[model samples]
Target: MPASTSIARARTDAADRLVAADEPLLGLQLRCGGDLPGVIAIPALREAVGKARMLGLKLARPIIAQDGGDSVTAWVEIDPRDDGCLIEFRHWRAKPLPAEDEGHVARRKLAAERQIAELHARLDARQNVLYAAAETAELAELAARMDAGRGRPWTDFVTIPGSAHQQPLHWRLLDGAPVAVAGSDRPWRATLVPVGLPGAEPAGFELYLGSDFPAPQQAEPSPVAEQIRARMIGREVAPVLRQPIARIIANAETIRSRLAGPLSEEYSGYAADIATAGQHLLALIDDLTDLEVVEADDFTTAPDRIDLAEVARQAAGILGVKSRERGIRIDAPKEGEALPAVAEFRRVLQVLLNLVGNALGYAPEGSQIWIRLEQDGPMARVIVADQGPGLDPAQHDKVFEKFERLGRSGDGGSGLGLYISRRLARAMGGNLTVESAPGQGARFILTVPAADPAGH
Candidate 1:
């Protein structure tokens, strides 16, 4: 090799070696912090500082705080040949200390290296045997939501319209069941149950009214409409035995309250409501769990339904927690007027989520997003208006287009959410339309007719 080429190769090789060296340090730190990527620098720094501290050596670079104490930054100087970052726990502490063991300095340095090596080996071993728990946390949250539903059909979550090639075919749970799924050709054998099996069963959670999958080739519905409908319900075997669930809560409350007379009949009735509500929520969840699965399918469309007003209320209730989290208000009519729509509840909810989520995200931290339902003789209209920056008339259609960024890409976007949503509404018996000019806020209108049944 020529001199210049050799020098270039040497630089590349040296950089690769530096990156390799950093991996082990970062891995060890991640292990100690229970897989937290943030605290990685801490353990890595201990190794970086070990030799210097043991030999009465000092760092050429000073330690510094970053992000106003949110994180700590430090530099390591080692022959300029090694290029890497160092991590030390001394971030919280203002300064570093050199030890006073001059006589035993060499031995201490050896001991430190041995200790760090052993520790790193142990952490590596654990990492190898175990798994990244973040995935588990996600499942746990899903399970919690499922449990909240209490034996209702669990719909998979989908947000974007796609071939689902981007996602895994299915997700296996720690317990070995395929609890979640996506991008699959085969129908799952087991009805994936969320972890909190018995926990979210508060009351009378019943299964779906029936297993009547819609006809797939019904023009508007997909050619795979029946399959999608089957996919929608998934497997919600049965509701928690409501009487029993209510008994459990009532008994617990009775035990805690020390209320006499074997608890009033009304107390049990109230207990039943919690379980009933839980079951209703789960039924709603079964409707919702499909949010992600459907979103991921490019060909996915909406099923026809009526009662768009009820869906709006249902959506408002579902989003109630999210809105309240950011001090935002999601308004529903105190006395709602019936606005029938031939549409899929889930698809409609998707629009609600987008408009609501967008409103919450773009509007001032504390603002209200309203879902208003209005009815005229043959037509019913549902409006979702956000107090955020209204879209310009030019951008109205563009905003509904897929992958169209409205300055909210950082909000964990597939960007196709709105496009799929609008498509879903149109696929059913309605069209999702937006009305707003630049300076004013935006309003999304979902209009469907009254002739359709309660599919909405």
Candidate 2:
């Protein structure tokens, strides 16, 4: 090369950070007018540095590289030095590669591959499809194996929208299945079974398909609360079960208390146990349904202008009977007191009920539980203070996690109440937090946006 010929250079320490660059590299921005940092901006240069460090020898190669949209051909050399790897570049000139058309085609193919890979990754993560194997079958026969159909292509079993016709073909390439929505608005989860010898490509395939939703006409009813709620809780499952459970509890109560005809002590004790078990089962169902609702991706709260103090009092009232039974007194906000907050009325009540219920469960007998409300700038708050043994600092984070009960089992708690409550509070643009020391009583704080006078 001539003495006056130009070259670009850069250097990086063993940590792969840019430390030095020549004038040519200082002005190189890859694609724009901005200057490049004096660091190792190119992966190829970094690889060369790493290689030089590993071999402890000088290395040189001529390669085609890109600076933004411009392609540059240059000779690069990396030498291991005490400070780090020193890189030298010579004749970094823009040059178009031969067979440009072939390069474009290769790039397009890689992009398509990346798109398909991403789709497969998503489907795999969701457990949307499973792989199976069989000896010989057509698509329709495969469908029959899955109980989809007996003698037709798997495609015929699903009613794919016009834009989704290629979805099934794509699934075949990925060795998986595709989920298609049926005309009834329910989803059909489909899986493909490969028909071939072990470790061999599928000679044929079978299709397995099923509805994603539960069948309403089934002989046994779904015990899930969310599934029941989806069809209107009161109109479907709750009315049927709650009424009977209530009657059973009422009758059990009458027998246990001897309010009806006189009963033997043994039968009365049995009735008491039955009622207790019934109550526990009912509470479990409630917690499970709440769990389902809060965990749903589309779960949301209906925000409204409401009074935090009012909600706190309502929660206290609802738990009053239980509080009295335990000889625990509830101190709620004074009548007509208002703490304006922006949140959903029902959701706020739900969160407060969970918190207070927890407090009532743990608070010392005859101790007072205070439900207080206040307004801070831009925020409204409700503080539930209990005389229960406070939580350790270490347990604060763990308590809000799902299925966490701080080692307390058989307490009729599913460990999901706090988790679900916190989620609901957040959905209403608020948060539920706790403050306590091991010796100090626990204080739970619920905060939400302050309601403005304009009803915003």
Candidate 3:
């Protein structure tokens, strides 16, 4: 290729470290819009390049490059082959078609049209497994097992009303009509769309599979709208509901304890049950509201330098009464023992309280629950080990899933505690994990980013 005709190129490793660049690529100064370097050096483009390299995929985009007074429209392609990204670029001035190089202009026009069609295909692809025509009707194992069935006949896998072979398959897609596809194990709907060079015969058809689940009758709310609704409910409804609920518990407690006046034994027992039920209701309400808050897109935690040991101690103390009632002892960290971690204090305390409470619930009477703190490199760890009937190996991960209680009955828990605790830990730059085997009891580990002593 001629020097000017050749595409400007560069190479970068998986880490996004610049390994090499051609003379033309480096010589051509690019910018985002102003003085800064544009297409070649922009963070978003580099990130895309890095992703393509890591995922072993091909990525392409059309970008604008300024060449003095001229606005150059450039097509960039990053192909990951072997280990690094092969970045290539082709550009044309953004002006009327050049008469002298009509052939070159035509090719550029075709590429631009292809890009437009590809963009539409991608939008459809978001909800479907996109596939292109090959010599055989094979399916590529992509997007997980969702798109698996390679090297098979199109007619065997898909059922178009009057089509057979790949050519007619492209026709079905080119017709822009819905076509039913045979699922590997069942029947499902799919869409085939023609894709190839513009103004030429399509080389293959783009296949899109219908989702197994039926579409909602009503459109689902957007994340932002969901967040807004969650915030509104959390702000306006929780406090309003909590006030009466709190008073009911308080009044029930007074009646049960007979603090105000003497009460009959039967009445006192009824009052105690009411108080217990009210407390359970209050906890459920709090959990439901917290679930909404955590699932919201805008959920965030306020982070600061907090001692993990102190948080664990405070959480154990808060749940101590219940532990004592159950005859379960909480073994917390000794005084002045600190494990500095970077996290929000209240959130950490809430997570620890949940873990300790869970241990207290499952552990046998007279058994001990240990809350130990330690540090590993950049992470601070709080391990809560219980002497309860241990979890099955399979149940370890499942327990962390939302609303998963592993068939435990009458626990008064909404099954959101572990889920919410894990989310809170992650929001504060940490994670919560469990280690257990049947008959061995369970150990819950909470790890957070350790804080620098100097920063504290």
**Top candidate, metric TM-score:** 3
Candidate 2 regions off by >4 Å? 1-228, 231-247, 454-456
Kindly report which residue stretches of model 1 are placed more than 4 angstroms away from their true locations once superposed.
1-306, 335-338, 407-409, 451-456
The TM-score of candidate 2 is 0.48
For candidate 1, what is the lDDT?
Answer: 0.42
Q: Model 1: per-residue lDDT, tens digit, 194-234? A: 21112332111111110012112222433332333343434
lDDT of 2 at 115: 19
**Model 3 Cα lDDT, one tens digit per residue, 1-456:** 122445777776656655666644454433223122223454344666877877778998865433333334557799987756788877633433212244433333332222212111211112232223211011211222232333343334445555554533334443434345332232334444443323645333444443233222223444433433345345446544544655566566665554544333445567768766766776887787778878888889867777777677656655655676688888888767988888876578778889998898889999999999888899999999999888887888899999888888775788999999999989888899999988788999999999998884
TM-score of each: 0.43, 0.48, 0.49
lDDT of 1 at 233: 32
Q: How far is candidate 2 from the true structure (C-alpha RMSD, Å)?
A: 28.4
Give per-candidate clash totals.
Answer: 28, 7, 8
TM-score of model 1 (CA atoms): 0.43
Clashing pairs in 2: 18-39, 18-40, 30-67, 30-68, 140-152, 142-206, 142-207
Which lDDT tens digits does candidate 2 get at residues 1-456?
112246677776767556777765555433223323444545455566778888899999865544433455568888888778877888667643232345333333322222112111111111222222111111222322323222233454445543455334644443334455332344544444343333644434434443324323334433332233453333355334533554455556655554454333445578778766766666665676677667778888767677787677667765765787799999988767888888876688789989999999889899999998878889899999998889999988889999898888777788989998899888888899999888678999999999996775
State which candidate has the highest lDDT. 2
